[model samples]
Target chain A: MTPSKQEILSVAAECFMEQGYHATSIDDVARRLGATKGRVYHHYASKIDLFFDVHREGMARLFAAVEPARETEGDGATVLAAMLYAHALAVLENHTFESVVAQGVQMHRFGATTPGQRSTLDELIASRDHFEALFKNQAAIAKKDGSLADVDISIAVKTMLGGVQWSLIWYRPNVDSSARTRANLAKQMVRTLIDGVRTRAALQQDKPERRPSRAK
Target chain B: MTPSKQEILSVAAECFMEQGYHATSIDDVARRLGATKGRVYHHYASKIDLFFDVHREGMARLFAAVEPARETEGDGATVLAAMLYAHALAVLENHTFESVVAQGVQMHRFGATTPGQRSTLDELIASRDHFEALFKNQAAIAKKDGSLADVDISIAVKTMLGGVQWSLIWYRPNVDSSARTRANLAKQMVRTLIDGVRTRAALQQDKPERRPSRAK
Candidate 1:
């Protein structure tokens, strides 16, 4: 049977994540998919096309997962929690694609992309910025509502998002593959991040100076 | 003027971090250093040697920055805070070297290294594991002391460390280059991470049920 475009892209993402862009070739993707080179070529004109498609799909999946939470009607902290949960789940579930997204981001940052790919790189970067803005907007609201700690919003948001995305580096699907486990882990991660940024007032009603030396 | 081995390693690290291991050549390093290739060749036989040396130096710098804090006389929470602060500072101050370390880790995970480099990679991985164990040991002690939240220690350590290391991706020394700014940023980051994992009882004297839905 002819492999679908989605299948090709998925395999390509896995290969790229495993071997990286320069090391991976069309033959590798085809071999992994158990399809002919012609099969992959039918879907992607070149390796770069396959890579960028995977990158785009990764971002699309992220937006799909988190946008609903951003649109949810709730307090800033609540919305932010939902978004964080969704993002963590996506990272765990779609590890390969997200890994590609991360590689693409790093490549762009370090000028690893070819000049011809500059436009696509820019568009992907813009999408990433837009995704970050969603969290930043909610964080601003949370800070105003006194739900978040009085930390720099940019630093807090970047650190929290970095923590969530860093799962790509440490998480192994083969280790804990159960859906319930993933959901629980996601919830725990979101809670830890939210609680970390939460205002001291929200965490306790008294004894603000418990850790006097470290207290802000 | 002859460039010291230390100077070569630093410049080589910057080159490796910016252009990646494969793209960077000895000539590039030489040109960047305003010296001939012979100078670099005199200190290091090949680019691989330099890359691995930079990786070693990065790990050594981290150990130097963090080990003192781990050995300091304090509770786990305080010790962890100091360690985290030291780590963040090391990452910011030695941005190029740390970036190389991160790249080396990724490369090692992906099996990008040559067969000959396997032993070196193993040694570096051991160093990384040892570093993580320090944080985990402190976290366990903190948990026993009722300072840390009741959560999975492995997940917590990985997620927290991931967040701290993720600074490599987002932090730009050119943007906020001042030592004072870096120190302040590091403190804030450490606080957010420490606060996030601290037990509610530790964070507050009352009102534990305020966010009941998220409460463990």
Candidate 2:
């Protein structure tokens, strides 16, 4: 069966994440989709184009998750936590896309520029910076409200991102790891990151009535 | 002048990280070292051997950082902080090797099996688990002492690692970002991770006398 463009992009992302970009081909993605090269090419002009689209889609999903939280009428901690939880869930749900995006992001500095490279690279950077800016702004607010620890904004942002983004590499869909279970786990993970920035006074004021017990 | 085997390994790691494993050739490494392929082969049987050595060196550096903290006489919090600080410094100081190791680690499950694949894979997994276990043990101890938050150890450990390991991608040596500056930044980053897992009661009792002021 000829797969849809979306299907082709999804399969291509998984292939890119599984095998490095230089090693993967449009044929590999087509074969994974049970389609032909012509079908894959009908949508994406080239492998590079397809990879760029996958990256754009991943960024879009992340922005979709956090953008709403950015507009929410809540405290900085609440906003940051909401955005983080959404971002984590997005990463868990779209592991292949997220992983491919992450790999592309790191390799962005290394890859040789091709036709249309500059524009795409700039767009990618802008998308990423925009997403990160949300957290940075909230962190500023959190600090003003005296909810956050006296941590550098860059360190705080990167640390929070590292915790969530790394999930793409290690998290898997398991029998017992249901959607709800994963969501809760994501919340706990984000809590650790958010709490890292919480001031001592904030920590005292923001205790949850029900906390997960330590597994003995 | 012909470079030593140590220099070859170091240069090869940087190449592998910059150009990737498949795209990087042994000849490329030799050229980087102003040596011939024969000189490279004398120390490493092939590109695979060099890559493996790079990974081993990366793990050794990380273990070296954390192991001393484990032996020190300190509370769980102090020990965990020391280990994390050391780990972060190792990652920053050896960004190229750490980046290559991070790439290799994530790609290990995808690579084709070689003659000693099983044993090497087992060894890699064991080394990684052993390193992570130190954090887990400390978290367990911290819990027993009621100093840690009631979060899952697995989440806490991964969160902590994700923050530091991701630094390989974005961190750079700059004029203002001196060694002392980076060390202090690493400390702040670790504090966020450690604070995430610290109990509210512990948080109150453990406030540092000095805090980094918000960036103006």
Candidate 3:
């Protein structure tokens, strides 16, 4: 396929992801794209601009994947399952950008940014907050309904988020086995978290270590 | 007061934490301690040496505080409570080294290290794995007993670790309100994590946005 603007973003993301935001110069990104400095500048004003654009593109992809299902008629469990599935898939297929976003988030935290970067970061954060609110409310509704077991929605939300964020530590999507493993891992997390995996019913259905203690 | 070796490590940790490991020079640290380069180098052979020493010292303080109690005649919940308390105290007090350790660990993932740094990092990581295993076993035993509710031990362990690691982001020891606030936060995490927090439980038992959840 011809290198469109989206294609350029993809290539640039790889450079930023590999070399880090500050270390990656625009000249290198342009060269990687098989384009010149002027062409790169025409598309993106600065290195930081491309970095934020990549972040924006990433967040948009994430939100696009989950947002519709969240608005759908699915139950909380179904919706969370869909969300986790999409997230896990993204982690598997998009290792470089996924890792970049995680590290860039830390850099963004250190209060060392140009005004342009900060403004873009602010918008990115708000977008994330909006995304999180969707999950929180979904979990909250699940708690209210009998679909979910007893748990704090607030902390549960955090755990769910952390589970996704921290997985960048070990998630390698290039391998086929990794995809299934990650998908199962995420699905299992939802099941155990929302349904209480060690519930009396599950205990009764288990082996000794996995047995349920509450079923009379 | 005359600066002790402990004082030197403490001050060095602060500089490393604020300025980052590669970014900080020993001279900057010496200046902070009102000591000359000779004194600092005498205590620590090289910058890497100094960084590793502080890292080990912080880890030792952490393990020391939590080890005795876990080995004592306490159940997992009790032991975990002790560990969490110790952990929060460590983050609040040993801010510098923990920050450097966090940086060092991040650097490790990218192969950004000499052999000495990697070896020391391996040691630190092994110890951390040990702590994680300790918590995992504690949770497992607690789950088997009636002391803690049934949940995935892995999820709980990661969240507990994430909570402490994240404290490096917002934990400011000089702030008086946060001291009480964080202690309670740590305790609340312990409570809800091992045992499910009933909706009827005190609201103070849960904090807002434990780990960047989507709470609106």
| Winner by DockQ | 1
**Candidate 3 on A179-202: residue-level lDDT in tens?**
567666565444433333233322
What TM-score should be assigned to candidate 3? 0.73
> For each candidate, what is the lDDT?
0.82, 0.77, 0.63
Worst 10 residues of 1 chain B by lDDT: B197-206
Task: In model 2, state the lDDT of residue B26.
Answer: 93
How would you encode candidate 1's per-residue C-alpha lDDT over B66-94 as one tens digit per residue?
Answer: 98888876655667777888998998899
* DockQ for the candidates, in order: 0.37, 0.31, 0.13
Q: What DockQ was computed for model 3?
A: 0.13
Q: Best candidate, lDDT-wise?
A: 1
Q: Model 1's CAPRI class?
A: acceptable
Window of ten residues with lowest summed lDDT in model 2 chain A: A197-206
Each model's fraction of native contacts: 0.35, 0.41, 0.07
- Which should have the higher DockQ, number 1 or number 3? 1
| Residue A137, candidate 3: C-alpha displacement in angstroms | 3.4
Q: Compose the digit string of candidate 2's lDDT tens values, residues A1-216.
A: 778878988888889988978899999998888888999999988888898899999999888877776776555666677788888888888888988888777667788767587678778978888888888888888677655656787787887888888776667654426888788878878877866533344334434424687969
Better candidate number, 1 or 2, judged by DockQ: 1
Docking class of 3: incorrect
- Report the Cα lDDT for residue B23, model 3: 61
